[model samples]
Target: LVDHKQTALPALIEQLDSEERDHPIRKLAFTLRAIGDQRAVPVLIRAFPKTLLPASSDYGIKIEDPELKRWIAKHDLGKGRSIFSYLRAFREVVGALQQLTGQNFGEMELFGVNLANTESQRHLQREQFHQIAQHWAHWWEANQESHGVDPAYAKARVLMAGKKQGQLLDKDMRETAAE
Candidate 1:
């Protein structure tokens, strides 16, 4: 059996099925924290934020951990319950992904993101994502391996484009506007 400890993290990520990423190995790695092997550190770091150990007997991660009380007593994060540390942990994921991928991964929009108005998010109401999508086609042209990418979202984009192009069908309106 090949020892995964010696394997490159990128290769391990490519090899493991998504389920394997969530189970025993991920738990063990997080429990150990700094897994010492630099090659595996990237993979371990990616898993850390998501590894939800048994928070309490009641079992609801959204409810906050027991250590949270101790942290409040210390006043390190100020009063009133807020998920600041959780938000900060997310930045680590972004930082690591940026290091691994070069260029910012923040610009990329995954197909399955949760948003009330995905159309607006992808095009209309303006998120950082619209510019990313504008550039996505070009990125795809350059990288064939990205074919697994989700379908293009364009309803809001179409609306935004029409708005920008002048919301008038009249030839005179178009001509005058062009000038």
Candidate 2:
């Protein structure tokens, strides 16, 4: 909190887990954002296990071996060696939030989607991705990540599972979508 107003810390932390429930990073960021008491920049720099980091059942993402993971950890995320470090971009995320809310926060911590008007689509896509993820667990649980089930079929199965579980769809929801 650049302006050091940690009063909103709780609400901002809540937003971290709110982006999309399936968003592991968001949840991780929740803790990180809270750890520094809303000062998010340093929280990530200390290797705080934010998201998938070559670990266990992280819901089907590939887990590289220890050595490979170490190699990956040492390297920055840019494929084409750009000057911008992931951490820098991360700070920008926090900075933008402070600007948009006009809530002067010192010790700047970044959370949430980019508030850029262009990024409204980005937020929508992020939301849709969570919806898509609601399907994955069902597909994996029922079909074992697909035993001869093609991608399209798997997707349909996910929708069915999500609907059956009443995740984001109910009888009325289905009717509304149909209309």
Q: Which number leads on lDDT? A: 2
Expressed as tens digits, the lDDT of each residue in 133-176 for candidate 2 is: 33323323344332443343232211222133324433423443
How big is the RMSD of model 1?
A: 15.1
Q: Write the per-residue lDDT of candidate 1 for residues 75-140, one digit (tens) a residue.
A: 222225443222222223333333333445343243223223446543432333233333322333
- Per candidate, the number of residue pairs that clash is 0, 10
Sum up the clashes in candidate 1.
0
Off by over 4 Å in 1: 1-5, 8-93, 105-114, 117-179
**Candidate-wise lDDT, in order:** 0.31, 0.33
TM-score of 2: 0.22
